[model samples]
Target: MAQDTARQAPPTAPATPARALLPLILPALVVGVGASLLLLLVNGVAERLQDLLWTNLPDALGVGRYSVLWMLVMLTATGVLVGLVVWKVPGHAGPDPATLSLHAVPLPPVVLPGLLLATVLMLAGGPSLGPENPIIVVNVGLALWLGHRLVPGLPGGVWGMLAESATIGALFGTPVAAALVISEALAGRPLKGALWDNVFAPLVAAAAGALTTALVAHPALDLGLPPLGRPDWGDLLAALVIAPVAGLVGLCAVYAFPYVHGGFRRLGHPMLALPAGGLVLGLLAALGGHLTLFKGLAEAAELARNPQGNSAGRLAVLAVVKVAALLVAASSGFRGGRIFPSVFIGVALGLCAHACVPAVDPALGVAAGVLGLLLAITRQAWVSLFTAAVIVASPTVLAVLCIASLPTWLLVTGRPQMQLREDGSPVR
Candidate 1:
């Protein structure tokens, strides 16, 4: 019998040792922490920029007087600037903002620096987009890139998972938003081991990020809205009335948002574009009153604080006008996160909903109403729930708000979206 060379036993390959894995994981975590730290430093800067834009734009632009053509001119001007930035640096430009969460796709490490610049420019310049997504994406991408470059032998997926969790955790200043976003984004993907991997790194990163975010900028997330005294029979009735009214308003905002966006995109010519949107926004602000312009967060918070000051007519008017303004400001050409304005619109609408029905607790009704709209349009129930809780300033309301958010979300998901996509893409 001849010995067959083909049948020779295969040589055993070396198994990956714990020591080898340590280098890859360690560096990636370090990069992630650095990114998180950077993000934490910038969060308040972004917030302050957003505040100035929302607070000052209307008065500065001489809103409420511009004609339609003038508004178009204003919009065109903004379009030009936005177009220039997007053209020069497309990577940092975030996903269509009117949709759900502030989600950004991972890109090359080179893009992170540019993205950071773009975020500051857009938010500071008064484009109606948010900063959190860019903050998260840049961190995540940079961490993974550094990991790969440093340890070429490591599994890319491991670095990716860590980067993702840490960046998001840092960006939001809380693990809750990061966790909720992860869960929603992975809706259909195979679970596998993501449950552990996607979550743990962020918790670690967030711990550091939150401490830094607070120490550096002192972000106050909890506003402490009062809790609702247990739902009475009146509260149940209030809920019914709210379902239809809020649903209609939410539907319209979702439906109308694109047309607002399209007008600017259509101009195509950037110079002639921004001024047009500006003029339109100016006039609308004038027509709807000052609250009609800018991001609307302050206005919403004010209305929630003093709902009785505005008559039923004013709140009702605000509910319609603010939504239109946001759609226009956001859609026409300005860039910034939809998160603040969306919450504002929801809170304002909630206040209006309370006015519609006399029996409901104004605060509770306000909380429920705002929660409903955010849940529908953003489609992130967890964020919506927290946001509503933050607004009311009460733990007790959080429980009821949580319950109310679900039915509202279900109602919204059932509808056809006219503009914002479930996955964060916009129609345009």
Candidate 2:
């Protein structure tokens, strides 16, 4: 009888693991599908608008696709359009971008349309921003709204975490990146359970989100640079030195963010502020040319295609112009995220370092350059290292990057961040 009881207990033991995983699996699927659909809807609209701006409208006007005057007209017009949406639409199209972080309380359903409209205009108008923050907000709101009806047992915070994780995973083109980012975020917070217990659901959601995006429309974050050769002592030294320099360059932008945001906020209305900001952006774009426009992904690729082709001075100019553009777009009431453009700036800064020292391994130079800027801009060491490594896809450089980030972290640890506030108080 005892033996029979033991056998019965074994059968129930198998059920425990399955039961434990089912909760995670179900939420992951829901969040993943939701995230993918949202991305497709948002990206699809922006792409069409982009086509109209670049192709149909230019053709209709009988102007070159990149005619300087037409570009200026469209950008200025875009700002006006976005301003109208923000001013007239519901929820004021969410909060001020300058005042928000990568994570925030989920916005309400009423705010989605205006936010979407503002985002579309920003992307099509060639602002130095990306769809990251807006889309994340949208997804998080949608998830919470639906989760209440569909999965009432789940807490609001879980939905928020899952939604953010899924979106970050999809945007960066990898679940692992999202995992690391989330881990860093959850590292010190007091919680009720094991860290993995909380991390499990988010990871599942991230994987599903990444896979779904891959099937529908994949984003490529990889830089595909030439592989690093055998380890070199000289390259190691270069990384240590170059990373801190990159941090200093990024610090210029970080320190300038709030002041720039405050200056634009002084305009006091979207109608006046955004359009004025846009006109200034247009002038800058004209000087920088088309290469300096947009969120910097495509242009970064263009610059990377021939890093050596650009002189150090030109690369320096590109970095400065982009930082200025990012400040303008982010501060002046644009609906977007800073990460993508920051990555581009980091790339430009990295290539600038390579240009100055032709003998430094290109892989090491680029990785270390990115490391410094990301450390200062993001203030997340793990994210900075992973992103730097992903740009070159070289394991050989990882050890050096890890070591280089130490000094960079020290340089940026307690400094002001690139964030703003509604009441004009300091970020802390």
Candidate 3:
């Protein structure tokens, strides 16, 4: 009789009831807004410090703000400062950044302060990395720590997902990017429900985060390039050639990543490795000029604003130097993301393509270049496509970008990724 009763009961529902997800909306909203605020605060503080170091202090000292001497001093000093935090601060700033990813495990709350401090220092000190990875880690850590305490019934994974989606949305100032990224992440995972059911909460969080950031920061990703009216065969041909070439360029960095990271690890300590890395970056900076120094957003914008300002050779130099700088900073002890720097490299390469072959539309070159580099570096297909398309702010470029991505994706797939494993090997 007991067996009959047990068998008669229906199996647990395979999908979550739509109403079951409704309760998550409020928490998602809160997490989303908080994530954006955190990003804003970090960036604001970094920008202020950057101004102090590069502008006010330089003016007072009567030195050119971007002089080779100043660049060397600042970068090396940044390494020392960050190294001190990593060496002395508790938890050693979480983990070796080489082993971390944009979707890293939530770090202990104890590690958050030191990690953030090191990240801010890297940003202000002019490393060729972006705030995305560290910032996402910090947000995820905070959300899980706080949310678990406040709502003990909910799983930590829920909080982590909300935070990650929220942060990505804030980073790009669009929930669409977060959705695409999260969807890609969800592709192969086991699921108890429809994909939309699983994504509902995250989408809400992402929307809130994106809205908060857009309202506060007014950030813009569009490059304001002249429109590519229609992609002719010539344009298609340019995208195909330019994207793969750019992917090859980015793959150069990916192949070298482990070796570079291994070199720094051999230095035996953050104190030595970071400073040495800084010196190398300083040299790259001097070679590439001030435009190549920071995380590449503003600099990429500067490049796009006046593509005619630089010759093809000069643009090529900028692209190569930025890639080298990114590799060095990431492989060393610096705490930041590779995405922004990759964007800059892509833009420079695209502009160089346009300059070399005036018949190729600048927009197509830039978009294709970004698509290839992003595919090679981040290995996130949705993000690569989204970012490349957003750069030009044109739907017309999508058809070409879609086709261009095929060859680029094929080239990048199965290659050693830019990320490193715990054993200091590349993730293949």
Each model's lDDT comes to 0.59, 0.84, 0.93
* lDDT of the structure predicted as candidate 2: 0.84
- Per-prediction TM-score to the true structure, in the order listed: 0.75, 0.93, 0.96
lDDT by residue for model 2 (281-330), tens: 88888877787788888788888778688988988898888888998998
Number of colliding residue pairs in model 3? 0
**Is 2 or 3 the stronger prediction by lDDT?**
3
Order the numbered candidates by lDDT, best leading: 3, 2, 1
Which one wins by lDDT: 1 or 3?
3
Model 1, span 13-69: residue lDDT tens: 354454544444455447556766776556546567645444455447765333444
- Per residue, candidate 3 scores C-alpha lDDT tens digits across 234-308 of 999999999999999999999999999999999999999999999999999999999999999999999999978
Model 2 vs. true fold: TM? 0.93
lDDT of 3: 0.93
Clashes of each: 43, 0, 0
Locate the minimum summed-lDDT window of 10 residues in model 2. Answer: 10-19
Candidate 1 TM-score, true structure as reference:
0.75
Candidate 3 regions exceeding 4 Å error are 1-15
- Point to the candidate with the largest TM-score: 3
Model 1 regions more than 4 Å off:
1-80, 87-101, 109-115, 125-128, 150-172, 194-198, 292-294, 418-428
lDDT of 3 at 290: 97
